[model samples]
Target: MQAALQAAGQGWHVFPLRPGSKRPALHGEQSCPRTGPCVNGHLKWEQRATTDPDRIRAAWSQAPFNVGIACGPSGLVVIDLDVPKNKSKGSSDAPDGATTFKALCERAGHAVPTTYRTRTASGGRHLYFTAPPGLHLTNTAGTIAELVDTRAWGGYVVAAGSITPTGTYESLSGLQTAVLPAWLRTILQPTPKASQAPATAVLGRSNRYADVALANETRAVASAPVGEREGTLLRAARALGRFVAWGDLPRHLVEQALQEAGQAAGLTAAECRSTLRSALNWSIAHNQTRRETA
Candidate 1:
């Protein structure tokens, strides 16, 4: 409880978790055990999570619950390094978990920055880092490497000092969270400009309007909610693809933006490519139909 208060003091939004469990201490119709029907009891703790001391006090006062820190609002991203309780074989010599993490760092050509590391109850590790601006990194598994996962926006991580049946989340002494590395950023949160079209092509005034439209649509896709991301990506693709149909923007540029936006929303590169192809085809057909009608 004291740890939770301290986290709130440090400006990290916090909420209570069921004791020794990672589940938020939420109440709902399905959650209640009483014979009476649940009344105004479904708690959306993720949305209601706050830094207010009085609320924190009231919450922890009820029971010795664990602390859960909301990652996005706190501007934090956590890389969860989970070791298998049972060992698994790979690549004749490759090991999963922390060993895989080491290999990943080596492959990236840099050491994992010294940061706030927490040892989890199951002997896993959580490395906390400040999130990059405007990029909402989501939970990923096996994307970085085997047995490695990440927690970011729309997610939460158990904070240090929380105790579970397995063990406690203990912080390693003498380390602070570090800024995310540029190379890591490239893998985790790539930008649309990485594959930008060359400047050699002279743009006519008609094309200039398309350029502005693409820029706005790109921003909208980037900022869309996770639940809405796929639709947003399709919409952006159709809009930009319309410009491509009209020869206002290069087809490659529209395709690139859709690829970047799709990946940002956790789609595989191949998935993005496939979706872009379908969306572009629909857009071209729709535009042709409109032109014929006109």
Candidate 2:
């Protein structure tokens, strides 16, 4: 066993399990008791027994759920997904009980949870729920991804941002099912408001991470010399805004455009969805016109 384990790690932190002496793949099994007994152990379990009341209270305030996805000197990221209430649309609920992006197979229905580790010594756990029949992954994935981290127990999908995590299986051979119920409690301990706007850093406009294309576009508009547009500035602004809305661009970038468009462009993030709706109609009409001309 030691020989095989060492060979597998190719000389890494590999430990050989001596029948019943090893811990039960700790994280995958243990989890915040707020749910049920450790299901396939995907919640990435952790429990810090602190005697300090204030410290305990403070720690507890982070989230009723423990298990985060991170990679720091501490070996994992310690994230508290408890966003401010106002930012959450005045709801006391934390995103899917901090268990969104549950990892599962497409044909296998709902699987285990998802998780991810970050460079910032932080990680997140993605909670997976069964995708409704015929529902595309894009539909509710954004909302879920926006709410939870990707590396707690069952790391979520940070890139594809689809149904995510490919899921946590019980045994490499056997499949298991885990269900996360909705949180039903209001009047949560008061949390400080997120300053109407949480810190929004204007990341550089380099195509460093090409996947962040939407972010690049928003950076362009956000830093755009508002006066650069000629006669079609309005149209350009409108088109840009519509493009953002029609596409599932990053939320921050979408807002950046809305801010750049300014009042004259007459766009608001909340009201921007209609822009895509209108663009779709225009595209349909233009297609029909092209057919006629052809």
Candidate 3:
């Protein structure tokens, strides 16, 4: 009960999870009693999660339930850095989420921003950030990088004090949550449909250099060998991002062209967006510096 109250005190909506488990304790829609909280209709875990102290106290008093924080209501975007499931398998070379996220930060010329964080039972970490105002971000899995998932709207995370069969979730960094980084926000933002209009109509006929670079890079990505496709996509995005930075090409145009090429090459939409966004962010940031120096 104290665990739930503590979470609620932080303005995070809390719900009960089954004791010694991560699953929500709330009755599901199929089993809705249609009474009390569900008198009118079924309320899913997200809807039922509340910051009300009385409700929390009442709920937790019944059992030693774990606490779950509703990310959307709390205005949080949590980056979940998870470990590999089987290190002994042929996946020994697979990088963990933390490593991938760190590499991503280095690519973008930034460090991992210090913020409120929690350590999960499975030896993973949850880095919490405040969601940008007026944007309804949803959950993402393996989109930012392998084993890196995010919980936002439509998702909940186990609170710091929660415990499960594997281990306990504990607060790692008690620091205040940082606002979601702009570069990451760009990546997480939903991609609009590709434009059907000709590129020359948008960028003007004089940008031949950028036009050629875009075409060559995207074509390379499309024709890249299966094993090398991701690397090819990353390199292509980084190379073309300079054009976007120099204002020779629109960012959306670059994104759209590369996105189509990536999809054509059999890369998942999420994978393409993640790779493109990260690579472009890095190239744009550095290219701006190069331009200033030149």
The backbone clash count of each candidate, in order, is: 0, 36, 0
**Cand. 3 TM to true fold:** 0.69
Off by over 4 Å in 1: 29-43, 88-94, 190-294
Best-to-worst order by lDDT is 3, 1, 2
Residue 255 Cα positional deviation in candidate 3, in Å, after optimal superposition: 11
Worst 10 residues of 1 by lDDT: 190-199
What's model 3's lDDT at 9?
89
Model 3, 252-276: lDDT tens digits are 9999999999889888898789889
Q: Rate the local accuracy (lDDT) of all candidates.
A: 0.71, 0.27, 0.82
Model 1: per-residue Cα lDDT over 1-294, one tens digit each: 897987777677898899999888767546665432224454455656779998889889999999999988877888889876464333335464778777556543457678878898877888888877787777766545567888877889898879888889888744467777655554455223312332333457546767877888888767765445555665677667766876677789888876886777666687567557866776776564223211
In candidate 3, position 175 carries an lDDT of 47
Q: Could you tell which candidate, 1 or 3, scores higher by lDDT?
A: 3
Could you give the C-alpha RMSD of every candidate to the true structure, in order shown? Answer: 11.2, 20.5, 11.4
Q: Return the lDDT, model 1, position 72.
A: 80
Q: Which residue pairs clash in candidate 1?
A: none
